[model samples]
Target: MGKNQSSKIFSPELSCTARIFTLTPHFTQADHAIAGLAINHPQLVATSSARELGRHSDVSEASVIRFVQKLEYESLKDFRDALKKELVNSQTAGNSSVSTQPNTPTEALAQVVALCSQALQMLTTAIDIEELGRAADALEKSTCIHFFAAGGSIRVAQHAAFKLLRLGYPAYAQSEPFSQIAQASIVQSGSVAFGISFTGSTKSVVDALAAAKENGAIVICLTNFAGTQVTELSDIRLITPAPGGILAANSAQTRVAQFAILDALLTLITPRCEYVEK
Candidate 1:
């Protein structure tokens, strides 16, 4: 695409989610807060200033400039131009897709397969293998491992802890807010604390990681958003892509992916030992 076209694609008028996806890994704190605000109010974001956007989004002006430059733009002007193009393309794509009821079972199955396949592609694209390896190393070497998560992510945490424990590792799974914090406060250094959150924005989990850090434990995070607050506080962060459109998205599949990752780690860590012993 030409410079002008690219500029229009990333314009400030884009939807918050789109803006986030279009410039992720490259976003600074201010960019994310601004994108989050657009989720609540899109139009006002268009006319907002650095200071105004910062105040409204609760981020700093310096962060706004950092966010822009991170997206590979020469300046905020270039960033805005790129955003415009992204906005235009997204609208164009959405308008062209029409959901139609399938006339046959085979057709419906085909549609399901296509969507899952696409989701798998996105999940793989977002994962960082090196980060996963680091997390595995922490878990393997730790004297004690604590896993904490809430909501949909709790299941992933529980399952991972189970598999790891069965492989002869002492891993605890808890979602209780206070218990998580308490456990983190005491876990010794060289131990591991794993926190799971799809958005990587769960305050309690983040706090728990902080406590674990203060106690000298290595912290690892499994999340769908890279470079989020959770990642910032973690020793290593593993990410996966969101399935998109909250209502249509399948958290189950994401959990399954996280489980698969844990399974792989267990397999690598234990050769003679089985996950379950007689």
Candidate 2:
């Protein structure tokens, strides 16, 4: 069998979502079912024996082993242990959204606030300040900044552009795909192209950033996962924690994390822009 193309080496502190996201739609039906239950309902998998999980997911026991192996886990025991640990950490950190449950409004509010806080706290470790410095350095030299994103991430891109504009960089965001690609096409060495994709797999944003990179613009990506197309195209990668469990990728909590990531980057870029080398 070929090696798993997705990032399978778990970062103990990182949410397992990133690897799973990149391994997607290509997954076998058995694999998909297993992954879904594991994420949104870990109690169904983390504690089950391989055969029990097989019955639970309506697949064969061998299929159960194959699913975990596809994620490149060392063994069923290792996979379950890692999943259990992730669930515990998430619960202890107050990141308590499982995507499979209903909550009262009060409980929901608390859950969201806690999730956002957890995301921010994870950011301190998930992000590499030195790599972030590289992004700031790119912004300092680029004559203009172009932001690219699609769907829910469009708002995030717009927010970033506005922030940079306030900081006095000639920043632009094209909501339309055509305009984005066209703008990227004309960018040259003195430009910066910023991409925002929570899953790090949005095709339009990836295309725009690829064009930007091809044309010599510095490409920087804000994403929740590594080793995705968006990150592959980026010269600088800014990672934030993936908010919530599976199937909640577009939840408002994700935007909170994303917005925080941009604010952090802006904070670093802000001071540099003020000096204005005349």
TM-score of each: 0.64, 0.68
* Candidate-wise lDDT, in order: 0.65, 0.75
Clashes of 2: 0
lDDT of 2 at 162: 77
44 Cα displacement, candidate 2 (Å): 8.4
Error of 2 at 213 (Å): 1.2
At residue 88, what lDDT does model 1 achieve? Answer: 48
What tens digits encode model 2's per-residue C-alpha lDDT throughout 7-122?
A: 54445445455445435434677776677667567766888999898888889999988887766676889888877777776676455553434357877677667767766665
Task: State which candidate has the highest lDDT.
Answer: 2
RMSD of 1: 6.7
* Model 2: ten consecutive residues of lowest lDDT: 93-102
Runs with alpha carbons beyond 4 Å of true place in candidate 2? 1-79, 88-103, 243-246, 270-278
